[model samples]
Target: MMWGSSEEYKAMFVEETNFYNRIILGWFLPPMMWENLPHFFQTWLRNYIGGVFLYLVSGFLWCFVIYYWKRNLYIPKDCIPTRKAMLMQICVAMKAMPWYTLLPTFSEYVIESGGTRCFPRINDIGVPAYVGYLLIYLLIVEFGIYWAHRELHDIKPLYKYLHSIHHIYNKQNTLSPFAGLAFHPLDGILQAIPHFFALFVVPIHFTTHIALIFLEALWTANIHDCIHGKIWPIMGAGYHTIHHTTYRHNYGHYTLLMDWMFGTLRDPTVDNDEPKKVC
Candidate 1:
């Protein structure tokens, strides 16, 4: 068989990639919960389980910080999402999560076979080139995501069939940290397509790529909270909240660079006129 075409290599990759998942699963699942499973199922299982872990942890952590530890800090008492709304968000996110993990699993398959322009070690390209490649990779993802998001709103059919599920939480009363991943499964995957696509266009570090993809779960949670982080250039929650309301602005992820370039950027100050208590 060709390289990475054997069951052994696939098993190896799944176990290696599940480093974090295995740690958590060790406590909950039986000693050999993963042993009898096929490699394909193991990969999907670890991904889905890891995603659920991240979702609950990040979503609740943000809720605690904003609504409990520091009540009325970023949003008013009346502005917080109701329990039912948050529950709907959680339900939608969990439903979409299984499908959302598929892309990363496919990405693992590609990386396992050396199918993309990925380098496992910084020594492969030196520190300077590694940093440069990282920047380039980010740019590709940013630009791709900007358009992918904008097109989702601009294209009537796409918005109606795929993206409107996310827009359901447009108002502050409905939006929350949990609403970040509260998307149609296809919608979430479509938006994340850029992160994977960048691997083909740039020499991305394999570990860095995987980390960024997972970090997105937390980042999205942060941006849906309606808190203006004031991290200029970065698209903070204030910007994203307005995007939800306006439906025609702030169509970039991670940064405002693309939104500014496309003239779709709107200042978050209008809605964030309240006290600026950012963390």
Candidate 2:
């Protein structure tokens, strides 16, 4: 009923499933090669290979934009990290990749439990419903990550033991695409909980959920890249770059809505005039 007749839905699901499998697997392997792979190998490769490929691609693209374009050259040169520091940040990010991989499994468990629904086919739900669910998911995730992020700073024990590792890049330049994921594993997990929780709280199509994951990576990189500018209420690189320098404000991940509501929002343009040391 949520879609259509059982038979029609199943047929649509099968067609969409094949389409995704082809597109994903084809990214790394030629279609001719992937089509001939054993069933088990195909399944395993798609599961383990697909997400990581997308993550790496997304990170690389953002980093390229920042580095090649010198996107925020206007920022004081001293705030940028040295070449060695940038390398170290990338290494730390590599260390955290395994934790990122585990996140999807958590979402999968939620989906299997009937607590969440993810339609695999676009046709299964109309475009309007798909867009509506995506908006709701974004709102839920923004609210959740905002509080989780703020608590990571506000709570003394959490800050000292876990969140402080991320605060190391308390200035600009030292941040890179990888720096976005270079958190203490606990810190990364805590922030990611909202993303998983969104799946349970709303009906998100599988494709939309994948897009969210990619967006998370890209946005994280953009924020750390320290390009000063606001995208309306959504805090951009400028907002988060200031957060790194000041360490007490601009905690929202995607938007300033929660920060504005809670009075934690700090305008980057005003605050940048007098950057403070991380206390």
Estimate TM-scores for all models: 0.89, 0.79
Cα error, residue 263 of model 2, in Å, equals 0.9
List residue ranges in candidate 2 displaced over 4 A: 1-61, 68-78, 112-115, 276-279
Q: What is the lDDT of candidate 2?
A: 0.70
Q: Please give, for residues 1-279, the per-residue lDDT of candidate 1 as tens digits.
A: 233345555455455666645665565678587757765566677778888989999899889989889989778888878999999999999989999999888898787765677766677679999899999999999999899999998999999999999998987778899999999999999999999998888887777888899888998999999888888889999888878877999999999999999999988775564333322
TM-score for candidate 2, residues paired by index: 0.79
CA-RMSD of model 1: 3.9
lDDT of each: 0.83, 0.70
* Ten contiguous residues minimizing lDDT sum, candidate 2: 1-10
What is the model-wide C-alpha lDDT for candidate 1? 0.83
How big is the positional error of residue 7 in model 2, measured in Å on the Cα after superposition?
11
Local lDDT at 97 for model 1:
90
